[model samples]
Target: MTRKRPLKQAFALLVVLSIFMVGFRLIPFDEPRISLGNYTIEDGFQLRVIASESLLKAPVSMDFDDKGRMWVVEMIGYMPNLEGIGEEEPTGKISILEDADKDGVADHAKVFLDKLVLPRGVAHVYGGLLYIDGPKLWFVEIKNDRPGKKTLVDPVYAEGGNVEHSSNGLMMNIDNWIYNANYNFRYQLKNGKWLKEPTSARGQWGITKDNFGRLYYNNNSTNLQGDYVLPNKIIRNKYFKPSIAENKRLGANRVYPIHQTSVNRGYQSGVLDEKGFLKDVTAACGPLVYRGGIFPESYNQNAFVCVPEANLIKRNVLHYKGLQITASQAIEGKEFIASTDEGFRPVNLFNGPDGAMYVVDMHRGIIQHKAYISQYLTEQLAGKKLDTLQNAGRILKVTSKTIKPNPIPDLSKASSSQLVALLSHSNGWLRDRAQQLLIQKKDRSVIHQLIKLTSLTNSFSTAIHALYVLDGLNALSFESLSALVNQSKNPETIAHAVGLLERFSARQHVAKMKAISTQLLAQNNETIDLYLSMSLSPWLNLSEATFLPVLSEIEKKHASQGIFQEAITSGLGGKEEVYLTSMNPTDLLKKDLTTAITNRQKKELNPIFVLEKNSVDNRTKGLKLFRSICATCHGADGKGIQDLAPPLKGSEYIDGSMKRLASIILHGVSGPIHVNGKLYQLNNEMPALINNKEISDQDIADIIRFTQNAFAKAGKGISADDVKKMRDKKPSGSGIFTEKQLLESDFEK
Candidate 1:
């Protein structure tokens, strides 16, 4: 009996050991564990991990639905390792994160959509979810967290660009239009149909808007770039690209990292400080104008920028004057949020429904795209074993220490009247979401309440939201707008009302508008005058004699301000010749205005030629390559990014000789080169493409054809054989060609 008992005990022990080994094998070996204590935020603020690995991975962008649930875009395939192998695999996904327990942390994650390739942007708009997957923008109705009735909003939405330079930030503005960065188009869904229109090409990564509806974005180097004026205001004459208002750099490129930073170009002189910290922003992106009311009043409207390469977030205080906006760094030699943890990559920022600033941390060591990867960066990444950090991401919530965040409200279930009432909410996210819902529902039942809300002079933001909502619903009437124009003491309200009054600029309302214009001219407010000048086009179309004098007066009063002159020019539209002919030639602004008007008219008459079908195909392919590869330094418009490449549009190198251009493309050019008479002394040499096996000779020819057609006088055909000859005649010692050498080369023959 004793021997039998011992045998049974031995069998039981074996079973227990087997169970232990099996359970241990199920543990995740590769998942990286992050410590929240590694972060260092500014005083009076706290950062907490709301979601992390196992719940989400490699989140680049996110949007909140009407229910306050977060829909995150996971770019899982982005730089999975140092080699970036298998990046083309469809591993990206859009996930719905919910804090069902309400403990201020996201514990439940559901894959809303999967099998996406490098999905970059997402927005909840027009009773559907809009998302960008690679080159296409798609709209899918979300039925019970599942996709239904998928629609292609745009096929070439963000085509040809690698993830670094692709269009992102699917932000829905208060003007009822969807805008993106790195692309030159805006989208809208009006009455069950999609409308797409050309807008000024904006920043490289994330995009945002202020409470007043002016867009704000940034590139890789500049900290902040925003429009001084509102949307579609200055772009009236497509030929005249105004430089004062749109895409203006608002802040300096200075950055302050708390620790020694790891940057892609740290080896480059002036990129790193003496202390080995990032001296300036090398990867400044994802700018957000904070309107979350949870912070102190001084924090309102301040711009917070994400600098992932330095592992920091910067704060810029925005100063608003009469008609200008400028931003300065909030603290000297410090950052808003900094971390010693090199893996903390804050790629994007957002305003949460609960009045907190939510940060999307990609949590990967390699933030630089493979296309732009430098040898110095590759070595630095390898030495630190940083390239091994992948498949980890987190969503962090930042809130003020003194103020507690309120519970997020589920506006998806709110009635129309209830939604209208929330338009005045102190939280900008709530107000924006409320207005969006009201417009999407198209419920005119609350139009009367919205009209009443527009009259609330005490709540300027609420009044603005109400006015735009009314405009979106097509409920705005001439009577209500004119009343607001005449009675509202707020300059911003009056400006918006005047701009909206253009919809009512008919012969019957001419006299009333004329009277209102005269009354507004008497006020002498620059803000009101600017919008008045913009809104007078239709009235000028009807009675140029009466409205032209009003525009002239505005021009003469604010003649020193270029924005006002542009506004007046925008108001003239097709009648620029009449205004110029009537104005005195001796007027100080007349010469510049006449030049602008003449250039615009010239462009309108001589439009770009339509290429042949075959030529068009090649040009299209070239454009894709240019945007993906060259647009990083040379802007998408060929107008060169500041501190990077020189403008390619009117360069002598582009227009001089086709063979010289081809040689420069085959073997790159180093500059102190004069491009359009401006000397560009760039820090880094343009890397030679002769050794890049991925780019074929035909690809080089296509690029040449594109630059010639788009920027030169006409397209000059350069066959693949021509490019091959240029490649074969590689300069001795295999170095980039200097401008002197290029100018003296026989390739021009």
Candidate 2:
């Protein structure tokens, strides 16, 4: 009887195991749910992702346009949570997807932006679309309903550094004042359309405006978990009016500041629940003014409820300026959506015509709709801003205020004082502005100040401006500028000043240019050499005779550094010159010593040695032959690499020569011949002159001798008599040659 009871229990356990297995297959593990008070939501609000892949794979902010088209802004590459596996991110792109039929799946997608440098923020404004372009914000406005040209707004806002370096938000106010939210706050005044504060103002990220004309924004400096950092406070904002006329009457009036409270702070600070989990608590600013200025004067306020990060949508309305206390209400139960999905994560939010608040859910593949009791909040703010602008002009209440104009004397009228004041301004920018005004001043008193400004500061922009003024006054002299160049540390500034002196008929700057070159040689750093070389390249046009000496000096000092090699290669007008000149190959070849040839080869094969033995000399006949016969394709440097010519380095014909070289020169070999592994079809009429009716084999051998030992190889020389023996050899076209050919050639066997 006991055995029968055991068998029955085992059978029951098997039935329970099978049921649990089926449930596991139906649910994905990461999609956890959130719960509210008495109401339980069952994943209906969860994003209906089309693929099995996780939506947060490359999580970033998203945006939506007026057409309701959703765009997801993702940073490039996978975000690895583990150590040592971090890989470079692929180029980032902004994906614009549309769901025309309201189905959960995306209908079509187009690349809205590409090749962005870590671009994170995307805002869709009514005037045109704006995007985060590396370090700058660019907006493209469509023309005549067609996609329009892009305009660069202010490139950097100095909120915590350059706006380009920080991931912040751009929010538009009711008066069209664009408020830039970094970790700090900066606003554009509606009247001037300029920054309310300088680049120094910083604080907060993510910006939104309430309908009643109050500004709302948040700080991202606070937050925890993961390697990623996020601002702590859910929201922070300021209340400011944008009417210029009204603002003149009131001294910073109608501007107030506000902050949002979190759910964790409201409950369960000291007590732990019996279930080992705290009960659901929620908080988010509610009645947020979408545009500031749409309600009755007193109640025309709106607030952004800080939705608790705890997974539930908590709504609460706090006092506008004072942040007075108030009870919060729950909008949506947590279980309705994925707990990891933050609904308000995307920066853009607006109250729609359907009377429901629309939040852009970038990764979710849909626009989320929230029907709540606080929908009136946005409507009130928008109405309030409109009323303020309309009533601004009627109320002209003037207040006492004064602004000091820049101390630089206006150069438009005063000839002497304007020039002196501008040249004396403490900053380089002011000095430059003054120089321009002096161009029309025709004043002599400012010349000393201009020279002083040039000597005291090496600012390239200011020096150039001062040089122009000197030129106008006929005060520029080689002696004066050379003294300044000697003191200037910035090579570019010195170069520009010298150029001015050279153009002003200063013979002294010419010698100064050479002196500068000498000074450049003393610097050991490659950056200094690169800078000096680039600065001197322009002088090459002065006179090849003058330029050649400098080029030789550069080659002498830095040839071992590779700067000389670039200078040689870049200086050659044609390959023929490169082939014939005696560039310093010894220093370059010494590093790769194994490949360097012995002294015996150099002595025996010197163009002079080969010329005397073979009856062809490179100095006279070889140079004339090069220009007439080889210059067309080989260039002056004999580098031999033209659009059609191949480099002669390691060329088999030159290295193995006499018989092989003579046959091709005599018979004009055609068809595919590989040079450096690249095949090319030669011209059929390649005029050859081995021992042909045209010339003797002796001249041909000496010419080949000159080329073989030149440039990179400095190879062994061939005799003219050796070439005469192979005078009648076949073309040897259309086949790869073997070393045995040299042994079997008539010149050998």
lDDT tens readout by residue for model 1, 637-736:
5678877889876788877878788888878877688887789998777777888999988888878776765556434678888888888766665467
Q: What is the C-alpha lDDT of each candidate?
A: 0.81, 0.38
RMSD of 2: 31.1
lDDT of 2: 0.38
In model 2, which runs have C-alpha deviations exceeding 4 angstroms?
A: 1-59, 76-90, 102-105, 142-148, 157-167, 183-203, 220-309, 319-355, 359-749
User: Candidate 1: misplaced stretches above 4 Å?
Assistant: 1-34, 458-460, 585-588, 604-749
Q: Per-prediction count of colliding residue pairs? A: 0, 64
The 10 consecutive residues of candidate 1 with the worst lDDT sum are 605-614
